[model samples]
Target: MRLRKPKKEWRHRKQRRVRITAMIRKELDWIVHDKISMFILFFLPIFLIISVGNVEFNIDSRAQDTVVYVIDLDSSEYSLDYIETIRGENFTFTVYDNHENPDLVTMENAEALIPTTELGAYLIIPSNFSETLLENQTAKIDLYIDGINTIEMLVIKYQFISANLLYQVEYQVFNSEVLYIPEYRPEIDRSILENAVPNMIPTILYAVSNMVACQAIVADDPLKRMLLSPTRKGEVIQAKTFAYIFFGALLSLVCMCVLTFGFGIYFISPLDTFLIFWMTTIFGVTFGLFFSSLASSRLQGAQLFLFSFIFQQMLVNNLRIEPIVNYMPIEVIRQNITDIVYRGIPFLSLGNQIALIAGMNLVALGAAWLSLSLKKEVA
Candidate 1:
């Protein structure tokens, strides 16, 4: 009886192993049959690596025309030399003599010029600049940069610093005198972490939610079987979407807590910030679902989501078009988040941004529903 029982156990174990092996084989076959998915899954990383590796990072190669307004209070030969040193092929310096136009020395005048002339920065050379440099002391220069675009501000700053370094080197060689030009950005008060974290939160949340939800419907093999029953297609999609949204809300909360406690970042209005985060997650999920419904396989869905995300990021950030940048999904979320978190602007004031996000969500959700309704088998 013991020997017969051992044989029965062995047979059961063998059958279970066979069933698992068959399932694995079936999945392999499915993957092999889907050539497009296989290609994307295998070659996409290599393609991305090669493409990114070929990008140019040299700032000099991509230098754009920058206009700087110089407020020269010194009116000395040394000050003129300093200005000439900083000016390059790409940099156009508009020198404003503080003596001729006493009003130009005021911060109000500088601020006014930025809007009207689209000025990049203001270089204020102190009256005692030449005297201090001649006495072998470090002279300070006030650099009031247009802080609206961080990238442009940085480029202008680095270019100035680089040119200043060359001037110092040349002066030391000729006169054996020490010179210094310390940059001061009065416009920007916040630290790099404070300025960057708020902008990054929405983007990170959107990316994670989109990636996870992209495979929600199209990759779900059991969804087809479920649809065979009395379960409505809308119910399945709704349940899946709601499940992801709940998970996304929890994720958003965790991210907020980490930003607040772990990173010591404070939100002006926690409730409004949380609401925005939740809304961003919903949009991400819906956007992913729109792509997932359009795609035939999990890999295809993921690829579609990736392409869309990359395209929008490039369009919004690099495209100099005002209308497109204002209306892009990522840009809208980022701008509103920046306003609420950093500027302390109330959520109610951002009705336009909220409405645009809501409208986009509706369009995406409708498209996903339509796609699913039109096609019987999603997978």
Candidate 2:
């Protein structure tokens, strides 16, 4: 039995170019000739594999634990018991002089301590709290949380609320009374937990856009590349995008791993997370290509990439549907992408974000093809 010679037909050629993951991996393997490692090879050498301390989820790492200053005006057995139980993950209880008399809490005092000391959360165990809790009357507690610190502090706040409720439940239980645990989790429709997947497909579209490929396909020095004609402009563009998809995926994977294991954020489904990350990455690549295509010089591409970094860091801040949309030149960027008005999980409805991202990709790809076509012809 013998194999036939290559057909070299158009159909065969189309079938042959069906970019495979294994091939992409192999191409990346060749990127760092000797080192052939995954993320380190694609982006930079793994400089700090050994972090000074534990890795963090969000960019700014929190302290080992958040300290809760309990001005317990009551200091009752029940309150004291509750305080002891708070030592686990989110809350570390530090008793101030006045935890027993929460009624005496001044408005100014509450404002100063809760926000200034970087506290995770603050709570008042009212004088009426114990009696109302025991007399089968509904009790209310006031908590002040720091809103500036996004997910990490938010997680601690949720935990504190849960722990507080648990203390109430135990209060009723010991007093031979019954109280229903209030079950309100804001429906979590698209809260931070679900957001672990992705707010929008920024990373996915970023990979597809393939900006890293720009570096790989450039003719080294522009003057030298003008002397060659063996490669088509289209082929060069394709190869560069391929390289970006490879690199972007690597950076994103590291980010997800750090968020998951290093931080306690749970992913309901890895597949969903992967999709969201890859899509957003493709978005980044698309923006990169758009920059590369338009710039007269490669240095311009680097400058534009920096500009994009600034814009993307603030994407969700400025670009979102909200109750009150107001932003100054810098106020626009104070928030972040996740904070943007992505009402709920994206793509659940399957049109707007996907379309928006795809539209962006079309603009990028079109520009890339057009400009590269002209440059190739000129060469």
Candidate 3:
């Protein structure tokens, strides 16, 4: 009787394994056939890497003509010489005399001009600038910059500082006296693409995984019929989750390789970075599955995914409430990516982040399982 019971149990276990494998294969087939899914999973990352990496944001001779507005309050020879010395082929300077346009330096005028005109930056040479400098004292030049584009702002600021340094050197040579100018130069060693691509990895993985997985159960019309044939909802959900996660890992690998080999963006710990990306994919898939289970139709699932994505992005990027933002899932992922990729922090050092992500994944997976289990029919 014991031997017969063991044989029956073994047969049941084999049958379950076959069922799971079949379900996983079915899910993979669906992804391969779906045009949108294929693009998001395989092609989107490559496209983004190529398009974003090729952009040039360096402050060099290749800089496009930048229009700078100057309100020269000190119309002295020294100020004029300073202006001329700072001029570059890439800069088109428009000098406004204080007597001609006294209101140009006003806060209201600056606010209006910077936004409305093609003004890259507005400079004000103080009336006492020449007097102070002649007296062997440091003079301050008030610079109001249009900070809409960060790269452009940095470039403009760099050009101004470089020119000012040259002017100071000329002054020292002409007077044969030591004149001190307090310098403020920010260290910008990496290009824009180098800094941006690392931050983008987690976001891209999360977004694509979430987007594709949101339609997993809701869009599969055969799921309802399958459930009637000894296939439990939990098994179905598990199969779909496994399949999506497998593909998500592959997508993450492809993205990292493209950015590293194709674009020369290096990761300090490639293995650790890839692990974090894979974890992000797991979180994204489970989160989407929870929503997909809640949704009644494919359209509703898509809407939920879009709304969730936008809301998360706004919170992570724009929200200033630090206490709340710190615990948010996307924000945590972003911070960890920065730590691992940019700061070279080890993956195990981010214990809190990894734990939170794991906890969130479990909660999402549990919620999805419950939702699917309770549903009368999954359509």
Candidate 4:
């Protein structure tokens, strides 16, 4: 009888210990074992290196790829060759022949076209361009560029000067005692509010979508409660995902409408813009869910989002980070989306980006499923 009692007592104590250990584990999970902390510990340093810290993360790295117009007065072969040489990879050039399109050369027409065209710069080849280069010993090309973005203006300026210099070298104009000087008279676009609206749209979308992505799952107490019902955990997660997608689409639409109508932001293709925004929202939602699955609380999810955003901002276009940075969801979104909206590129052309987004969603969904399964086991 004594042996039996002692064995029973020992079994009870062992059971109690097991329960205590499990409880401790749960509490620890709620307190510290979270996605945010994991990233902070393991990946924070990498992100910091890429971002150069907060100081450089939010800097506007957005550059506008625009179109430049040209008016050719000299029909000489030299003038044509110079024009062809000045056409850059960063921008497209459209030559408007004044003789063929006389109505398009008026001051009134130019001023009207300023608002309508996405013209970054304009060039006028003087009538005596070839004559000046060969005989008069002076090549002065007139250029008027949009100076809204100083950096872009500088790029335009350098491209023109470099092209002219190359032309001089190729034609031996400089050696012929001719000064190949290019005159650039820049016109700063004073429509700051109008010009700034397009630049701001992507950042605004990213910020809003990031918040939505960071909290779509973690803050839902109702999702946790749903587990107590007869519903499977996968079903509950599916519902939450559907909600995020729907709400994300709705929110993105609202933002686009406000910008297009209220703020006068010009989107060349509304359908393309809408589709990109919707897809971006979907991407953001998945991003949040993936982290939230690994996170114990809403704050942790937010931290994850912040780390992601900073890494994206700092690492994008930085050759030091290269290939890996190119694969980031935010970078992909910014590149493809801005190309469509700002550069007027075709949406269908982004085959790689489209595939990448789909792949990311699959990965996120898998992560979310695994996380929910683990949570169920713990409960």
Candidate 5:
């Protein structure tokens, strides 16, 4: 009786161990098979970080090259010295001397030139600029900014204030009685939200391509059946690629129209802006395909895409990773587009960007094609 009881107890213990192992294996299988579970566990964190916490990552490297114009209404020696001090290594200034180009120095002219010039902002020195500092100890300056170039406007404003403060410090050190005070008057009233939409276009397109095109082909029942059919795999891949590009282009056009017509976000070169955005759409499509090819499942592909997109944005605009900036495809495209639309730079300047994006697309397409297996006819 004692030997039989020991044998039953061992059997019970063995059954319990088997059940526990099976439960763990079942959970692993579920995590692999369930797309929603995979996204929640892996991809949601990236999305939340990019979308919600992006306020901390709004830095732009391009702001360093921002240019502004200075209209010296008070063409005194003091004003010219002040203007010279402003033309430091940090920013470039286009000086319009009131004495030389008196016709272009009016307040009305400045307002009209705002729309026609590539200058982000312009400063007007009052006629009492030199006299005020030598007598009243206060100099007033007018700052007129293009409502479109928000980033450059802020940078120029900060640099202008810093330059004036430095000048004050130098004078105070030379003679304790001399006081230099500057008052700035802003001409345009605008908000940061006005330019946010145009800036976010690339990220929006990337997310769209990942969800609509890349995941659609693998997750849809009909597409999966086609993948298992006698269709030429290359042709199928081309069709999907074209569809995604078309959809992305359409979305970009719609967003641009809304920005141009509805809200009046300035696009100096409309054709250049449109073409560059279309090229970025191609980049987004290729990036989605690359992620899909590299990942094992649809959810995993989206997770990879989101992760890469966020990292690329940080590398290009938010962070100062110069060595890796040249290697990131979307970063190149975004920088070129920003120059074209915001800085009024010509499209021909984007020759390197065009070549780099083309190379990246070819590599991504080749990888995607190689990853997919075609169904062979059975004997």
Candidate 6:
């Protein structure tokens, strides 16, 4: 019997023939078939830009402004002193004379002209107000706060009352003593401000890394092929993971550019800013790849993505498993990645940023290697 021609046996090899280009084409095709999904993907960055633009964050602890209408039934020095005690830019005051029409502050006017339409709330100082104020008796001050500005109005009112009481005695001795307030020190709070981006970076990186860091086998089928030529499992994993990291890094760079030139993320050196953003990107994408490897299907991968995304959202409110989620690498896995927009970057100073990124990549690559199946399901 004639011997049958031996079937082709494959050996692993690397052909630097732009292997990634083939994959990119496949990804593009996937995008094409689903126009709606592709359209959404194209606009993802802009949507997030507008979405994040509306968000606000604060760190300083201080009182806010409030408006008060003082019905001065007592014009005595004591009553005046009581009013003077509450004297501060934090509160806006309008002293209504007893002879003046109460209509301006009447139930009718209060309903029509109070805080809802004005600066916030109004307080009434009844007749003999100064005599009782000096007597150390509980003198009543009726207040009407616009319910529309309820939270803001309440905060202002509480501060106004508390401050007025504290300084009431002080005014008795020093009529015009100006209290000194220390200026805010950015240098002292550099660490806190610098590390704030970690809260957002983890989640942001996760979404972008998926564009490149998907682990899968490439097979050659005439109708559908992910292979340009013979591609090894190890090579495929390496290329994909590296590309994923690159995508995150690119996204971070893009955001950094917009924040600096477009939205003004910071007021510092371009080099320094770039370094900080780069470090943040590394932490995010590396964590994303790690999560990707653990998943069994695209659905599982998306589930992982949602978990990271939610975790990032929680970080803005300081609600998460870790108190330091704001600065974690995993946070980049969400679209919520931050880049020292309001503060500085910590754990990723110049050299440390580089080291951390390199370290993370190493960890991700190692994980991918361990999980890659030479005898994969597709081949």
Tens digit per residue, CA lDDT, model 5, 1-379: 4554345442465654554444334334543575763464335423533443343234334454444556786788888877767765434455555565667655677667677545556688888888887774657888877767677667667767777776666444233455545554543343353445445666655555555445534543344554453344554556557656665566567656756665557788887887777777787777676566556566776787678767776777789587788777666766666678877788768787688788988888877777654323210
Q: How much does candidate 6 score in TM-score?
A: 0.57
The digit string of per-residue lDDT tens for model 2 on 1-379 reads 9999976562454533643333345445555553422333233312222131123343233533555555554567766766665653434444333444445344456667676654556667676766765676766666666677777576666667777666655544345445554555655443333353333234323432333433343313442353263444555456546766656666667655655565444555554455455556655665566567656565666566666655654554566434233322112212223433233233334445556556766677778867767664221
- Report every candidate's CA lDDT: 0.69, 0.50, 0.79, 0.62, 0.61, 0.50
- For candidate 4, give the lDDT of residue 7: 54
The residue-by-residue lDDT of candidate 3 on 1-379, one tens digit each, is 4554345442486778888889999999989999999898778877877767776533353335555666787889888877777664434345444445676654456657787546667778889988988876778999987788777777778778877777878655235455575554555466566877656767788888998899998999988888877677888888999999999889889988988898887788988888888888898899999989999999999998999999888888887477878877777877778778866788888888789878889899999999988988788
Q: What is the lDDT of residue 322 in candidate 2?
A: 49
lDDT of 4: 0.62
Clashes of 5: 0
Ten-residue region with minimum lDDT total, candidate 1: 48-57
- Model 1, position 282, has a per-residue lDDT of 87
Error of 6 at 329 (Å): 3.9
**Which candidate should be chosen as best, given lDDT against the real structure?**
3
Best prediction by TM-score = 3
**Candidate 3: pairs in clash:** none
Residue by residue across 103-160, what tens digits does model 1's lDDT show?
Answer: 6545667768775435667778999999988886778998887777777777777778
Q: Backbone clashes in each candidate structure, one number apiece? A: 0, 34, 0, 0, 0, 25
Q: Model 5 residue 160 lDDT? A: 75
Cα RMSD (angstroms) for every candidate in the order listed: 15.6, 11.0, 7.4, 16.3, 19.1, 7.6
TM-score per prediction, in order, is 0.54, 0.49, 0.68, 0.48, 0.49, 0.57
Off by over 4 Å in 3: 1-11, 57-188, 320-323
